[model samples]
Target: MGNQVNLEEEAVGRRGREVQRDGEKRGLEGPKVLREECPSSRDLLNSLRQVEKMLAVHEASYQQGLRSLRKKISALHNSTMAIFRIGKNASCPKPEPPGHGRRLGRVFGIGHEVHFLCKPTYELIGPRTRVCLESLKWSGQQPMCRRVNGTSNSLASFSPAAPSSSSSSTSSFPVSAALSASSSTPASSSASSPFTLSSSSPTSSSPSSSVRPSHCTHFLGSTRCTCDVGFTISGRDNNICTDIDECLLFPLGQPGRLCVHQCVNTPGSFHCFCPAGYDLARDGRSCTDIDECENRMHNCTVDQVCVNTYGSFQCVTVECPQMKNATYIKTSSMRCERNPCMLGDKACTQAPNSISFHFLSVVSNMSAPRVLFRVSAARVLGDTLRFGLAGGRGRGHFSVQRSGRQTGTLLLVTPIKGPATLEAEVEMSELERNALLGRYLTKVTLFVSLHEF
Candidate 1:
């Protein structure tokens, strides 16, 4: 029995080797072979069961790992796609074509701005700066710069006239004498008649043609009556004429007004007149505002602003903060608040030089709340200052006006939810001969806390 078992075991080993070789040729992992054979048939059956159990456990672990790897790869691919989408959406639009005016800036991307400049003799008709919006479009239409019309009295030189009434005659010359006169007479003598003549000679000397009425004239051998000024020929035979009212024909139209503010029709012509605060334009038919401010004709004080109205102007006083020992005064260039600090006095160091603002609650629209503040310094030469927000939480919300060199107004806007804090910073620098003298810094903090009562 022992010999028989050994022979069987050997046979089994040989068969296992053949199977492993076949699996290797096919690029597959082959099953492991047992080094020792079972002593009896019952032992062999038990060993086979254990080996099957181990193989099942390892297969389950491999499937779980494969599923985990697939999930990670899918997540990475989705992240990459999301990044590409954002890069594509952030692209800017193309630049517009050049117009009558010159553009100051070249960058035309989102949130960028461009300024327009007209020539010396031209005037701009729209916003000075156009900004690119988030919608991939410009905020407003491009402006146009057109030459100013200085010679307002030269309208007659460009005005259109009737095709038949270019030249005027004295109306005293007889049509028959013009026809009977020989070629020796000057062409100018017969051409004086308002009616255009095709030929100087009469076609026929019949009595009916020569006996025309006094009011009628002969042209092209045909008798036609002449119309008075402001009248035109209207009858079918072109003999009878009717009165014409020039005021009824586009008297109020732009560039072709026959009257300024009011029109009066006369028997042979029309007259134009203007209303109060307006004077007749150079064309003598339109009304233009009489600029009291431009002509130095205003009665406003030096500290008042001459704001031009429709037909007149208003004098408005400059607004100043209500503070102790501070008075508003008007200089040659601008209106400013005068304090001891403005005189370069050392007493300014003891006075309160900082201002504080508090906001306990905000409106419902917190997405973009606009807050304004003003900062003023002594009018000193070569002294400049810059204002900005320093905190990372609300840095995007602050914007300062760049126009005022010494005194300026700062604006803050931001979108917030719940409670937030803002920190503002102001930097001051002094310079002489374009060389820096000293630098100073100031800070202010604002706490925004809202309660849902």
Candidate 2:
């Protein structure tokens, strides 16, 4: 009976190993979705559990097997990452416990910060640290992250790698020390294989694996967020910048996949970054316009157009012609001739100095409510004018007669006028014109005129 039990346990271990190997092959197939959880991931997690159980049950032959299996599990774990932003961060989630696999820092930036291991489980997407700067308020829209000032590479919290107070400091490296610690046991020798700590400088490695550089922060790409060449955020915008996905809004494929470059957005500006394209100037704040034309990196065809915006450049097949007719949203209009004594030279201008708004009085349909105009102008409170008229029925819109003056009377002197005369150029909308017929002419003219008085 003991032998049979051993055999059954051994069989399960062998099967688990096979399933895990299959998982290794499948996991590396492609890029996983950003900030999401999938069933396959859960399945992989379950396999790790089974492997852990198998090692525990079939204690003898599986001891050595467990070591090898653990290595593979770690490798698989480090290949991906999961990004789950907190709408309102509740309790920080524990990374898949122990054998669950390596995931990156779930809570990034500052604000109710809880320390969880940041492991590079998958490719980093969006910003690495959603840092809320202490210099900013929560309701703030543009949050800031510290970008590396230069090319310094140091582990963020390693005991030996304390940060320097100098303006230039090494940034956070995108490696998983804590995640590495998960698979490596307290007694295991292979622990250090996954994590390399240099005795001289316990900080992180170079260019790629670095932390938030001192005095600079703006990350939209991954856990290993390196800011664009220029632009640092100490507490500038308070780290409330919303992600402006360039791919979603603009066509970025031109000029050798321009969108492939970094698309970091600043408070009032943004830039497209390339790995080795150009470096920012010493100013460290503004993106010194890269003259792509001079860089020999431009992918423009022989006859194409190249237009330079603030930070980046674009080559276009069809250039936009200058605006021929731009529509300005209308805010105010005025009636110029209220009194018959007003127009020196009556003109049809957009904003006439002397003007008035007309109010609707009699309508063709009693069922349809009359439309009234709410007037607002600096001249609305001035002396009112009166103009009396003889003609009672024109059965059409009447024109307001303006008498000659050096300037026009701009006040609404209402006592004048009956069946008001109006200039006939303005027409109502199609719906309104149709509704105006057979209606009693409410004969009132809204006018704004400029008089010396």
Candidate 3:
């Protein structure tokens, strides 16, 4: 019975071994026949699986290295194509000289210690003299050598690089195609065609007609164009621009329609232009002068009249613009009236029953064609009606005195500066009288009529 029992135990052991083998093969069974099998067998099987995963990880890393190498090769190939491949009809090219073959007396010029080996200047043993490129020593592969026909300063030719492929001649882009890009532009163009680069200057054979002015000189601050403002180039050539004057060539500043108007054109600068019938004032602007004689300058010609008009000198037998209350004063005094008080708005102060005046302290504007001054309370002191307002308290009186010259007629009332009666008096020189008298007066007219005078 014991033998029978031993046989049964042996049969069970063999069956367990077979089940474990089949499990391992199916990847489901292993040293453990089932999930509930011995734990030791499960642990051993897991350890073996870990070893397989580590091996796979190492192999995948190696494959990645191969992919990187492939990328590097691709980059190098593209670089080689860019640098070495020449396109047909290349725009600009570097010159390349032909190569000469190795001579019988050549040298292996490569490697470092050449001079120590070969003498500085060694001639070969041949009948035609030649310098040994080989250093003094008997070592090294190739040595530089040359025939004795040339002098020492003659350039030594180095090994030439490989020859590049040549291109055919008929590869130029069409000229019409080059010109098509900027048809609207009337200016010279260099856009379409391949323009040659010269270290010095452009060659004569090139189309200079299509080039811009090489150098432009400035006068004052403006550039001088060959053509004037209204004209343009008349021919295909660059230097053919023309000038045109629509106005008759009237001398500038003279009475005219166009040529040489009131403005002066220097080499570069230009003056403001004024039209005829308008007098050009000092600021070169148009202003009207009243015809005081017509309305009257003095308001009376034979008596005391002179008139002013815009740009023109005219005689008006009519009423004056300021006649109603125009206080007669010396024509020379007009400038003083512009800045009536040297102190401007601060010239006076207001008081309840009356107005007070501030002495201008140190006054200015005294140097004028006609100096005008008003004594604050001169007339208030009952000085001979020297100044009288519409409502006469005789509070003020103004003085118009000559400090400089006046070109035309002048009439003014004497100021109370002295005991001179402050009465309206006509002051005229012999020449002034004749000029004022229309019968003997010459009508001097304005050159430019930007202003009426």
- Compare the candidates by lDDT and give the number of the best one: 1
- What RMSD does each model have against the real structure? 28.7, 33.4, 27.7
Estimate TM-scores for all models: 0.28, 0.15, 0.17
The local distance difference test score of model 1 is 0.48
lDDT of each: 0.48, 0.32, 0.29
Query: Which of the two, 1 or 2, has more TM-score?
Result: 1
Cα error of candidate 1 at position 316, Å: 3.5
Q: After superposition, how far is residue 207 of candidate 2 from its true place, in Å?
A: 6.0
Candidate 3 Cα errors over 4 Å, as ranges = 1-231, 244-277, 281-307, 311-453
Global local distance difference test of model 2: 0.32
Over 38-114, each residue of candidate 1 has an lDDT whose tens digit, in order, gives: 25687888999999999999999999999999999999999887755664355346545335556644566666766
> Order the candidates by TM-score, highest first — what do you get?
1, 3, 2
Per-residue lDDT of candidate 3, residues 1-453 (tens digit): 999999999999999999998777888545346666656767989999999999999999989999999999999999777644533222221112112211221232222111211111232211211222223223423333333222332222111122112221111111111111100111121222222110111222332222211111122232222321222333332233222222223344566323223434321112345554333445433333433335433434553224343333433232212222222222231111111322333322110111221111111112223332322221122212122221211113322333333322222222222211121221212223223110011111111223222
